[model samples]
Target: MGKKLFIPGPIDVRKEVLEKMSTPMIGHRGGDASTLQKSISEKLQKLFYTDSTILLSTSSGTGLMEGSIRCSTLKKAAIFSSGAFGDRWYKMAIANNVPADLFKVEDGKAIDIEMVEKVLSTGEYDVITITHNETSTGVRNPIEEIGDIIKKYDDIIYCVDAVSSAGGIKIEVDKIGIDICVTSVQKALGLPPGMSICTFSQRAIERAKQISHRGIYFDLLAMYEYILKKDYQYPSTPSLSHMFALDFQLDEILKEGLDNRFKRHEDMANLVRDWSRKHFEIFTDENHLSNTLTVIKNTKGINVSNLNKKLQERGYQIANGYGDLKEKTFRISHMGDYTLDDINELLDNIEDILGLLNKVY
Candidate 1:
């Protein structure tokens, strides 16, 4: 039996989603391509809750993250990070020669409004990036509160990395005043990886036009103009496989009903939270736990590697701690097509292993 993935991403793709990737190839510049891409763009606009034009990339979500900040920022950037992925945004900025500063809260803590306001009010910064969900520490930043905070400063561009939380959680892009919002296919979208999709606003377009050296390939303005001219076709060749699956998987997601899907994720998260509380403690604060995954503190200090080995034999797999949190924490994902029954079964198996280890040999 294939081991079920409870990892943050490249999460267990549904059988139908997997098959969509095998769809026969198509011409990227042909009329058929326009029809396919245009259809996907329209659906994505509804998914993102915005009227802004959709921008699709042939790379991971990181590509858009790099492009958005580099292309649109006229001055320095203040990147607010709560965990590892959040830290990456700051690193991406510096690597691209963008003047940037990272303001981070302690691990396992969410970024607060006070820190955000302090940084933005400095008057030295013109752009800001917030990781909506930081997978490393299992913290989902309060984007609604943060978005409200950002809107107060009209000149500061608001960008969000919703990579792990977008489809699993509800994010209203236009209502939140997010100028650029990015996400990929693998996580809660229940599809295979390879491409990323983001929303681009008119204000962001104007900023990109002012920035001259925005690098090749990731140049946001070049992409937006091409799509506007070609009617949703990307400048370079696109990933038809990922796009095909995305179109189909989105249909499945919408058919399931957005509210129902969010509720399913909530119910599964609650089940894991209850289980984690019973056996191990949750790593992040209760107020900001992620709806898609739970990072459990190794309260008992068991050998996590051995535990995973046993889990594999039971036909399931979860993620070990990331970065500096290694061995100190373990993550169990309840995202994608996974159900409540799957969570219960996985927990029962974990209970059996914990019981055996507790027994005196």
Candidate 2:
């Protein structure tokens, strides 16, 4: 039996979207490919709510996050991290030899706005990276509130890692004044991995021009120049398969209506929240839960690994807690094409597997 994915990314792709991936191959540099690329860019602009140029990388969203931070920071960067993924971003900067400082909040806490203001007010940093959704802890940082704080610093480039939240939630990139809004296909876009998409505002482009040592493969300026000079095509070979799937999936997302889609995610999140409260404790700050996934503390101390093994045998999958919380917490992702009915079924199965149907009730 095919196990249903209740874990975060590479979420279950609809049959039609998967079929789109089997589309006939096209030359990456061909005119028809350029036209298709152009259309995807235009649609992405609408999706990002920005007139800025959008770039597609044949890598995961982490590639763009690395590219944006490396290319846009002429000076130092202050990376605000909430959990594991945020820590990874800080490490990416260091590995690239980019000068950066990381400020990490406690695992379950949201980044305090005051710390952001205090750090940015120093005017020592040229860029700041914020992860909008931290999958490990289920914390969605207050990017809007943080945006309001960072907007006052005109010289500082605002980069956001919205890899998990982009399509499932409304980001309003331009209105939020996010210079580089980064996302990937697998998470909320309901497509397979191997493609990362990001919006590069004119402001971010301008900043890249001044920064030195921007790496070759994922350079923001190189991508922008290639698209402009080569008719919306990328510098290296592009993934036509992923693009075809993304192009079709973006349409599905639009037809679902952005607001309605967000509402659906919120409703699913609420269902998970209520379930977690009844069964286990929510690990993250109660006020800043992620719409994409919920991290539940194992208050009952059930054998999570064993339980997951049983779950797998029954044709369902979920994520154990990340890092140190692996046995203490577990994650349930509500993103990508899952509905309330799906959530109920998964919870019911979990209840049955844990033999808690009667005890919890």
Best by lDDT: 2
Which lDDT tens digits does candidate 1 get at residues 1-361? 5689898998888889899999999999988898889889888888889999899899999999999999978989899999899999999998999999989899999998998888888899888999988999899888889889888887888899999988888989999989999998889888878888889988888888889899878888899899889977888998999989999988888899888888999999999999898778999989999999899998889888898999998888888899888899999988888889988888888889879446631
- In TM-score terms, candidate 2 sits at 0.98
21-46 in candidate 2: lDDT tens per residue?
99999888989899889989988888
* Each prediction's whole-model lDDT (CA): 0.89, 0.91
Off by over 4 Å in 2: none
TM for every model, in the order presented, reads 0.97, 0.98
lDDT of 1: 0.89
In candidate 1, which residue ranges exceed 4 Å CA deviation?
Answer: 356-361
